[model samples]
Target chain A: MKKVLSGNEAFARAAYEAGVGVVSSYPGTPSTEITEHVSEYTEIYTEWATNEKVATEVAIGASLGGKRSMTCMKHVGLNVASDPIMTLSYTGVNAGMVVIVADDPNMYSSQNEQDSRHYARFGKIPMFEPCDSSEAKQFTKDAFALSEEFCTPFYIRSCTRVSHTQTVVDLVDRVEGPAFAPENNIPKWVMIPVNARRRHKLVEHRTELLTELAEGDKYNKVTMRDKSVGVVCAGVAYNYVREVNPEASTLKLDMVWPLPIEKIRKFSESVDKLYVIEELDPFFETEIKAAGIKVEKLERSLCGELSVDAVRALFNGEEYEVESDNSLPFRPPNMCPGCSHRGMFYAINRLKLFVTGDIGCYTLGLLPPLQAINTTVCMGASIGMGHGLDKAAEGMSEKAVAVIGDSTFLHTGINSLINTVYNKGNSTVIILDNGITGMTGHQPNAGTGCDIHGGNTPKIDYVNLIKSIGVKPDNIRVVDPFDVTACMETLKEETAKKEPSVIITNKPCIFADRTVIDAPYFIKEDKCSGCKICTRLGCPAILWDGEKRVAFIDETLCTGCHLCIKVCKFGAIEQRSK
Target chain B: MKLDILMVGVGGQGTVLSSNIVCDVALANGFDVKKSEIHGMAQRGGSVVTHIRVDEEVFSPTIPAKSADIVVSFERMEFLRYADYYGDNTTLILNTQVIAPPSVGDGSAEYTDDKVEEVKKQFSKVYATDAISKAIELGNPKIAGMIILGILAKAVHFKKEAWEQAIKDRVPPKTIDLNMKAFDLGYNI
Candidate 1:
């Protein structure tokens, strides 16, 4: 049956269909939903690991124990899992293992947009980039088979556009693949330096074989068409280029790393003008050019995010008509109103202390209005940076708050918190436990009090987890951010204390939580002295009556959180009667 | 003429779904359309707005904000956020809502009654709404966005029948009676 599902949903369904034994991932945008969605299948063990690295390791161990396993994270998250990913590349696996990395182009909810394909090359692993939801489902299952065949970990990379977009996919029953029947190759499995040295040769041999394997793969193929134009594209960019020129000769590669050399050369030789169209970086164009093919129109000059418009510009020729406009139309991305982070950010700013931020929708805290978070390097870096900054400050600045989302804290944050305590650093870590991973479409996390199957994993208590990390118990404080006076007072007290601390803000993210009741606060037209005191909260639900010079609240938006009534000293704003 | 438009907003008075109601009504009257939206991250007590432009032909589902005939904005600072999209001929329907951004430290920017008067300097015409008072009298404080939509329906290109039809089609089966009352409350001025 054909079903309309998101890329993440399809990914999870495919994994379950593959009868994957273990699912481990720390929630981050673009990729978080895959694991969460997969948890719906009761036949497999799916979970939100503490971080991406641990998640990768957990998947590796389970796969070695003869279970199909997979772990996923956003592109930046690959950096956190790179260590395990590299070693696993050498160890290979008993059962099929697929590591899915979701990349965000345009940095939608991300702090940065570093390509993960580079890491795949660095780790000497083969990578697959799926263009859409259906491909995300099928390509992942394909990666698993390729992984077991080569005794190497397979990678499937998808970007935000592919990860978030919904498309139709055919549904089939979950066919549990046979268990990883173990075969002894101690030299292959155990890589002690001497044995590892030997396996390194095997790894090299495996790469050659994988390359040969990659060469015949159905993913990397070309439509031998009009000799006028030859193009190499992959993932979403592949779709873009195709849209621009339907009849243009194309070489679309699913397996990007350790590229299918013979196939590329064949595609390159058949066409006259060779153009490479891939987003972010021209990894394909660079590699093809290196392989001694007279390349024409390589996107050497163009860089950054990929879009159909960009691809259209590259293939601009007589066949493609061009229309140019000089308007520099802009649509800058911004955060929403009544966001749980806003009041907390306002509180953080009041402290005037340096704060290292982490990934999530909360990363928008660095943006204006809430311009409170100081530094946002990557996932889980907040605590690390916070510790580093605290040591450098060396008692000068009163506090350093490592602000991280609940999902990010699960992704790679807890360890950094543990490390900070172990290193005897005096810094505070604020686990912004908004329940769901709001940055990447509200994917569930370990701290969310729920699990993949909607089955609860003992929600790791943030306060208790902080203690386990060896931070002093007295230092940990749970505060509700909405209660302004309490939140401000708690921040003041936490900063004054000498011990390292962990503040768990238990406010539900406004987007997800709808329990709150909003009593309407309409402005008094006649008694209304438009002092504008109510506007301080910046709630979009309220509007200023221009002609009469009075405050008005948009009823539709009034969550009835009633923060405005407290601020309205003039008694002009009052709740509407039922 | 019947219309159905969805405006996304957070807990703020300025961006309370007024533009969508009016545009949806306009579409209901001899118009055809559908829209997709993203209200993510905006509910953080920040300025929020989305455009739903309708005409005889709109191939794509999303509204390209540039040609928006009527721009309903709840906040002053947000004007520049989507400023490039507005043409010189665009009507800027505004609610002089100003909330300090993170960049504006407390007490750094002074506020005065003449703030909207100054803001009107840029726009060809600034139609401001005191939606709060009207909502207060109606015993529904959250009706400002609809009030602005009502004001626009009366003044702009959209016909009133389309607006009523849209409300008729969109209001829930259970709330149909209440909503007709609400629609009249919103635009019957």
Candidate 2:
């Protein structure tokens, strides 16, 4: 059957048809849907692990237990799972193990545009890149075969262009196969010094065999057209190459990691001018030049996404400017109307606290009005960084605190809590527990008490979890963040303490709750003072009426969370019942 | 005939859902279709743009600048934001609703009153309507996205039956009748 599917959905369907038994992943943009879609098929066991590292380990354990397993994450996520992935390359998998890493070259929804292709080379694993949804499905199944044939973890790289784009895909039936039984090979599975030395040699030998297979890979094709120029490209860059210079001879590589030098050289010889057209870093050009091939790297910005016109400009030597309307007001992502994070951010901003932020919707609190966060490093780094900042400076503990999401706290913040308690660092930690993972489309986390398929599971109790991390029960407090005065008092009391403290702001995200009411708040035109205090919450619903010197809430946008009401000192804002 | 559509709106406006219906209708009509959307952070009341192309054979999921044939904007401010996608021959159907950005309320940027007029000057054909108001008149403001989809259905030559079927296939069963009514209002308007 033919259907329209995004690259992520296509890969998920392929994994299901390839008889993949276990699928584990941590939800990150451009890669979250792969596991979410896979969970729809009852035949496969899919899960949302705590972190990418844990997800990779779970997949590795499943692979060792004789099942075809897969783990996926975004490019930055590869960094977290790299420790296990690098070693998995040496130990290898008993059954096929495919690792899907979606690279965000444009930093679309990512913090950094770090390339994952380097990880494939660094870990000595074979990586494949698919251009569109059709190839995404085909290459996914091929990735499994390559993993089993070479007895190594295979990589399937999908960028934002490929992962989020939707196109036509042809479906296939599941390829049923028996699960491989675990073998009692201590030298292969265990990595002691003597066994590691032997495995290192085996890993090197496996790379050589994979390179030989890549040479004859049918997916890596060279279309001999007008031989004036040869553009070597892979993944979505291939589409740009073809769109720009359709008649020019091109080398489209589906297998990017272990380059088929023999084929590249042959294609390089056919055309007069050799150009490596790619986005971001020159991973291909660096190796191609080292192999003694003459190629010209295209002149383009190394930042953001590549376009069809951008590629054409490089060939035609013409300047291409992407037309944009700069007159429109910049609408950056903000905390949703009625968000629980607002009350805390408003309190922190008022108290003038140095806050270390983590990833999620609350990261938007760094923007103006409630510009409270001092630094936002990455996922689960707020606690540790805040601890270090407090310990490094004298009297800093009284003014510094770490703010993290419920999902992120479970992901890696617990370790930071342990470090804070054990090291005796006097830093306050705030967990914004909004029930679900609020940032990435409300996916279930360990705190959500549900699996990927919406099945109920044991929810992680935050109070006990904090206590288990050695935080005293007296120092642990759960408060409703919508109450701004109470939250401010709690923040002040916790930050003044000479020991580690945890305050969990408990509220469900408005969007996550289906039964949420739309009791929009309106300002009393008569009792209105032009303080602009309500805008400090940074809620999109509140609009400052500069002409009338009053605040007006857009009824369509407001959910009546009442955070703005709490911030208003004059009692001017009131929510009207629907 | 090739039809390149650009959907510009704020998040939570059901832009993705509308584009999905368009793609399904195009597929039902037996034309090759492709659509692309950047999600994740955009869901938090940020600017969201979706590119959709339908042709005998579509190669790329993205539409080049100044190449789109039709643009369906869910809000007035979003209409100006995606003006780059408009060509001289492009047909623009804009919802006459303004959801102020943070910069506007904070006094960093001005929300001009002539926003729709500016868009009208660029594109040859502009159809501006109070889509949200029309959806509200029908007792559900959530169907504002469907109202704009109805305008797009009239602008293009797709099977009405296919569109209705696509809506049924895409929207929730309970909201199907109301959405269909919203679509009819948009189709006639």
Highest-TM-score candidate? 2
Model 2, residue A558: C-alpha shift (Å): 2.1
Displacement of the residue A77 alpha carbon in candidate 2, Å: 0.9
Give a tens-digit lDDT track for model 1, residues A1-578. Answer: 76545577888988988889898987776677788778778788888777788898999889878999999888877888888888888888889999999887666556677878888788888888877667888988888788888889989988776776545567889888776665577877787898888777877898898888778846687787788888888887776676567788988888888798788788777888778777776677778778887677633333355544456666663222223222311123334445566567767866676788886666766654456778877778898988888778777326667888887787778778778778877777788787877755565666777765556666777777777878777788888766666667777777676667788888777656767554556777877777765554545465666556776776755666655565577777777875
* Candidate 2 error regions (>4 Å): A318-323, A515-518, B106-108
Q: lDDT per model, in order?
A: 0.68, 0.87
CA RMSD of all predictions? 7.9, 1.7
Q: Which candidate is the best by lDDT?
A: 2
Clashing pairs in 2: none
| TM-score, B chain alone, candidates in order | 0.69, 0.95
Q: Estimated TM-score per prediction?
A: 0.74, 0.97
Which segments of model 1 are wrong by more than 4 Å? Answer: A3-5, A182-186, A298-303, A317-339, A467-474, A510-533, A565-578, B1-189
